[model samples]
Target: MGTFGRRLLLAVDAKGYGGADAVTQRQLQEAIRRLLSEAAAASGLEWERWETQVGGDSVFAVLPEGASEPDLVDTFMRHLDAGLRAFNHGRVRAAWLRLRAVVHFGSASPGAIGFVGRAPVEVGRMLDSAALKAALAAAPDACLALAVSPTVFNDVISDAYTTIRAQEFREVVVAEKEHTGRAWIRVPGYDARALDLGVPSGAGREGATGGGEVPDVRPPSAPTAPGDTVVQVINGTVHAPGSVFGISK
Candidate 1:
C-alpha cells in the first residue's frame, strides 16, 4: 500500500499421488482442506478475493493492500508445505505421502468493482496443467517452488542462480512475457536466498537448507466411495480405517 503500484500475483496448486491403487485412496480431500486452512492461516494477509475452484485440490487468494508482499509469499508457502508433511505422519503409508506446489509471481490488481480478469485465471490454468506437475517431479523432497515473473526476475534470481542454467518451459516464458505489459522492476528482498525451502515449523524435521530424500511411491487404489474412506487425520498424518477397504486390490 505504498505509492508504488507493484503487486504480486501468486498462483498455487497441489496434487496427491501413489497409493495401493487409485481406489486404495489417499486422503485427497482431507489433505487439500488442510492445505487451504494452513495457507490462509500462514499468510496472515488479507485477500482481495480468495476462493476454491477446480475441485478442492487448488485454492486461489489475492493479497490485499498492506500484505507483506514477497515476505508474505515465502511465509505462506512454508506454512502450507510444512502443514502437508505434518498432516501425513503416522499413517500406514505416511512416509510415501507427498505434495507438490507451484507458485508464480506477477503484477496483479483487482478488476475495478472487484471482478477477476484473465490475470489470476491464466496463472491458475498454467499451474493446473504443467507447473504443479513439474514441481512434483523436479522437487528433490516434497519441496515447494516459488517462481518469479520475468518482470521481477532480475530482482529475485541471485547472481549465482542467474548465472546457472535452469530448465526452460514455454509456459514460464509466456507468463513472463505477459507480465511485462506493465512497466516494473524487481523489488528488494525478493531474491532466491529469500526462499524458505526448509521443512515447516515444529514438524520435527531438520532444516531444509539442503533438499531431503525422495520417498518411494505406490500406485493409487482402484475406485471406492469417498464416504467409505473414513479419513482420520491428526498432526498431518491421515488414518483410513481398515474397513475403508478398496486399497489397491
Candidate 2:
C-alpha cells in the first residue's frame, strides 16, 4: 500500500557501473552508500531517516518535505563531489567512483515496495537525461554531474536561494515517451557554459539548441534480478537493451 504526499526526490546512479567486473561492481555499490551517507551527514540530512529504494547501480530516495532543498543542490552536491574525488584519490582505477545525480519535487506515494508515481518516474528520467550525462562526460575532472528539475530550479536555485551560482546552470530539454521537461545541468567546479548545454544566452527560455553533439542518450539496460524492478531505456517506441552505461529500477 502507498500514501500520496508532496515529497522531495533524489536519484543517483554510478557513471560506469556495468563495465566493471563482479568485485568492482560490488565496490561501486558500497561506495555509493558510503558517499551518500557522508554527503547527507555533511549537509545535515539524516540518511537513516530517508526512504530509500536501492537497486542495480542506482538509488531513489524520498526525503521529508521539510528537508532543505537549497542545501541538497549546493552543499549536498559539493560534499558529494568532494567525497567522490577523495574516494578516487590513491584508489585503483578500477575502484574509483563517480555519479550522475538529480533532484526534483512532486507528488508521489511512498509504498511498501518503493515510490510509485510520475514523480519517481520523472526522477528516473532526469537522472537518465542526455544533458546530465554529457556534462559529466565533458568534464572528466568532475566526479559528479547534477541535474535540477524545473520546479526546483524555479523555486530555489535560480532565484538566489542557494550558492549554486545560477549562471553556471545550463538548461536542457529532455523528451522521452510520455514525458518531457526542461532541466538544468551542471558540473561542480567547472565552467558550465564551456560545455555549452543549450539555454540560449539571448533567446530567453524559448529555444534550446542542444549545444554540442548530444550523445546517444540510449541508456544501458541491466540484467534483472529476482527481486528488482528494471527501468529500461526506450529507443523510439522500442526498448533498446544495453546501449550505454545506464540505469535500472
Candidate 3:
C-alpha cells in the first residue's frame, strides 16, 4: 500500500522554458532532471527517500518526514546553484538554465504517479507567484530564486539551529488566481549591490539572464496590467491598493 505522512514538498521550474524549441526543450528537461539528482546526492539528501515527479521543464519532489529544511537551504540549494553553474559553463546562451523553487510542509499520500496532497498544490502556486517572478527578474545575477512557505519558514528556517540566517530572506505575499499566502524569498547569489539595481530591460544584454554569460532573450520586467491589484508589506507596514503598492513603475 502507499504510505502517508507529513513531507517536505519541493517544486522547481526552469525560467524561460517555453521560449526554447522542442528539441532543446527536451534536452533541457533531461538536463534539469540530471542536475536535480546530482544536486540531491551532493547535498547528502537520501535520494532513496524522495518521491520525485518530472515534467518537461519542472520537477516535483516529496521528501521524507525527517527531511531537514536547513539542509535543503544550506546544502541542496547551494548544490543546485553549483550544479547549474557547472552545466551552463561553456554552453550556448539558449541552453543555459535559471530556476525558481518553492518549499512547503504538509501531509502527503502516496499515489501511482507520485505523492498527492495540498502541499504539492501549495508549492506549485508558490512557484508561480508574481513576487517570486519579480524577485528573480530583479536579480539578474542569481541562478535560483526560492520561496518558502510560512510553515517552513517559522518551523525550520527561523530556528536558531539552522545554518541559514533570517536576514537572508525577504518577506513577500504570494497572490495568484488560485492561492494567496505569505512566503519568504532567498537568492543564493544575491549581494547587497544587486538588490539596489533596477530591473534590466532588453534582450540578449548583460543582466538579462541569471548566472554566467548566457543571454536571456526575454525582457527583465515583471508582468503588469491595468487595474491589477498588488498587495505587499514593506518594513512592517502593509500596503494595499490606493497606497504605495499601486505606484507606477
Candidate 4:
C-alpha cells in the first residue's frame, strides 16, 4: 500500500567520484549527505516529510506535494552553490566536489528501500546524461551542473514569477544509452551562455551546442592517442575536434 501523487523529484551526483581513492570517496559521500541536508533546510523543505535515497555518490530525493519550485530554485540551488564554493575555496582541484543534478515532476510512490516510480528512473537518466557530464568537465570552474526535464522547465522555470530567469537555462539534447530527450541546463554561478557545445575531451560523438559564440579561452591540449579527439576552447567556446556538428556558444 503505497500512496501515489505528483512529486518533485531531484537527483544529484558527484562528478569524478569513481576516480577517487576509497577513503576520499567515502569522505565525499558524507559531504554530499551533509550538503543535501543543508540545502533542503535552507530551501524550507522538511527532511522528515520527503523520501530520500542514497547510492554510492548520488542522492535521489522526492519533495512533498506543494513544495514551491521557485523557492527550490532560488533558495536550494543558491545555498548549494554557496556551500560548494565554501568547500572548494581552500581545496586543491582533486578534492573539489563538482556535481550534476536533475529535477523533474511526476508520479511516485514510497517503497521499502526508497521511492519507486518512473520519476526516479527518468531523473537518474538525466543525472547520468553525457551532455551534463561533459558540460561539467568542460567548465572546470563550475561547481554544479543541472538538467531540468521539460515538465519542470515548462511548469516551473519558465513561469513568470520564478526567481530563476528563463534566459539562464539553455536547451540541450540528452542522448545517452536508452535516454534520448530534451532537457534544459543551467550552472548556478557560471555564465551558462558562455559554455561551448562539445563532449568531454575524449567522448566519441557530438551533440547539440546551443548558445551564442564566444572566443576560446584555452588552447586545445594534445590528444593521448592518434584517434583521440581533443577539446578546443575557441575564444571561450569549447569544441570537440571530431564532432560532426559544431554548435557555438
Candidate 5:
C-alpha cells in the first residue's frame, strides 16, 4: 500500500567547483541538511526524517501535508536560495557552490520497496536527469539555480519570473584533465572560460566532476567579456537597475 499525495524530493549539486573532492562534497551535504532542518521549522512542514547518502553530498526527506501550496513553495525556494548563498559566503573562493537543484513531486511510498509509488528515488532520478541536461548546457562556470518538475511548476510556481528553458540533452565536446569526453547541451552565447578564468575566450567546456573537484587548467585569455545584460521588469513594466536590482522589500 502506498500513499497518494504530492511527495517532493530535492537533490542538489554544484557545477565546476574547484576544491578538495571530499571536503567540497561534505559541504554540499551539510548545507542541504541544514537547509532542510531550517526550512522545515520555518515552513511548519511535518518533515518525518532525512538520510544522508553518497558521502554527505546528497539527501532525501519527506514533506508534511499542506506544504505544497504554490505560494509556500515559492517562499521556501527563496529561503533555500538565501541560505545557500550564505553557506557559500563562508567558504573559500574555490569552495563557493553554484548548485543544480531539482524538485520532483508525485505519489510516494515511504517504506521499503515493492510499493507502487514514485518514491524519493524516482524523484531524485528525475532531478538528476534535469540537472545533467541543464549543467551540460550551462557555461562552464554557470551553475543551474533550480529546477522544478512540471507538477511543481504548474502547481506551485508563481507566474512572476519567467523560466529560461534549455533544450533537452545535445552532445558537445568537453575538454578536461588528461581526458576528453563527449558532453551535452548548447547554451547560446555561453562562455565558460570568461566566467571561470576571467578570460574572454570560451574554451575547455567539460562535464562537472563531483562538487569541488578541480577542472582542467587552461591558459587565461587576455580580454574580459562584458557581463550579460538584460532588462528587469516589475509589476508588468520594465524597471531601471536601481529599481529592479536594488529594490528592497
Candidate 6:
C-alpha cells in the first residue's frame, strides 16, 4: 500500500501497435523499455525506482516522491523525443517506432496490482482521446506527439516553468468516454504549420482540421466533429512571440 499525494504522472504509447505481428510487438515492448530508460537517464532520472505500470503497448509511470516537476516536462520530454529519433534513425519505415505521450500532475495511491486513482485513469483517458490520435494522424513526419493535462499546463507549462514555450502547444478539448477535459498538443521536430485536418469541404467550421488548409497556431473558435481538435493561438495578442500567456478556461 502506498500513500496518496501529489505526484508527477507520465504515460507513453506506441502508435499502430495492434496491426503489428507478434515479433514486432515483442520488439515494441523492448522499445518501450528502452525509450523510457534512455530518456529518463538522459534527463537524470532514476526511472527504475519510479512507480511504473507497463502494458503491452504503453507505459504508465509515477515519479517518486519529491520528483522535479520542471525536469519531467522540459528535460525528460526533450530527451524522450530525442530518444525516439535515435530509435528510428536507421530503421526502415515499417520498423520505425512512433509514440504518443501525456503528462499530468495528480493525486494518486499505489495499489496491489497498479496505481489505483483518478489521476492514472485520467491520463489513460487523455491518451486514448481522438484529439491526440488525430494529432499523430495529421503529422505524418513527426516521430512523437505529446499532450499535457490541464493541471500540468496551467501549473507548469503555462507559467514557463519548463523550457518548452506555451505557444508551441495547441490547446484542444479531449472527450473520451466519460472523461472530457482540455489538453495541449505538440509534435516534436515536426512542423504543424500546414496540417491537413480532416474537416468537411464546406461545413460550418471556424477552426477545424477540415480541408487541410489550416494551421494549429490558432484557437478553436467553434467545435468541430467529434475526435477532432484545434489549437489555440495568441492571435498576436501579446507583443512578443516568446511571451507566455494564460489559459482562458
Instruction: Name the lDDT value of residue 193 in candidate 6.
Output: 29
Please give, for residues 1-249, the per-residue lDDT of candidate 1 as tens digits. 312333454544444443334442336556665675667666775532442232334444444545554444356656766776666665544333454333334444444323244445444443443323443444435434444433333343322233222222111211122221111111112322222222333322221333332221112431111111111111222221121111110
Extract clashing residue pairs from model 5: none
- For all candidates, the clash counts are 14, 0, 0, 7, 0, 3
TM-score of each: 0.47, 0.78, 0.72, 0.75, 0.51, 0.77
Report the lDDT tens digits of candidate 5 across residue range 1-249. Answer: 455665555555545443548867676667666775676556555444432233234444444445554523455555666676677765675666555555566675444422235435344433344334444344543323444544454334333332322232232222322332222222223432222222123222322332232343322532111232111111222111111111111
Q: Pick the candidate with the highest TM-score.
A: 2
Return the lDDT, model 5, position 81. 60
**Deviating ranges (above 4 Å) for candidate 4:** 1-3, 111-114, 176-179, 199-249
The candidates, ranked best first by lDDT, are 2, 6, 4, 3, 5, 1
Best by lDDT: 2
Error of 5 at 183 (Å): 20
Residue-wise C-alpha lDDT for candidate 4, range 1-249, written one tens digit per residue: 578787887778888888998988987898897887888898898766766666678777777788877777668888888888888888778988888888888877766545666666667666766667766876889999988877777767776457787777766555433444556778876655456546343332242243323233222541111132222222232221111011111
How well is each residue in 1-249 modelled by candidate 6, as lDDT tens digits?
A: 468688787888889888888998898889888878888887777877776666678777778777887888889888877877887887777777888888888887756545666777777766766667777888877888888887787778777788887767766754333444567777886543234434332322233433333323224553222233453211212120110011010
The residue-by-residue lDDT of candidate 3 on 1-249, one tens digit each, is 566678777778888889999987887888887888887788777876776666667777777678887778678888888888887888777777889888788876765544555666667667766667777777876778888877777777776446777667765544444455567778886732234223232211222224223222223442211121223312232221111111111
| Residue-level lDDT for 223 in candidate 1 | 19
- Winner on TM-score between 1 and 3 is 3
Off by over 4 Å in 1: 1-7, 17-26, 47-54, 92-115, 129-132, 152-249
Ranked by TM-score, the better of candidates 4 and 5 is 4
**Worst-scoring 10-residue span by lDDT in model 6:** 240-249
Task: Spell out the clash pairs found in candidate 3.
Answer: none
Worst 10 residues of 1 by lDDT: 225-234
- Candidate 5: misplaced stretches above 4 Å? 1-5, 14-24, 46-55, 113-116, 119-122, 130-144, 158-249
lDDT of 2 at 64: 71
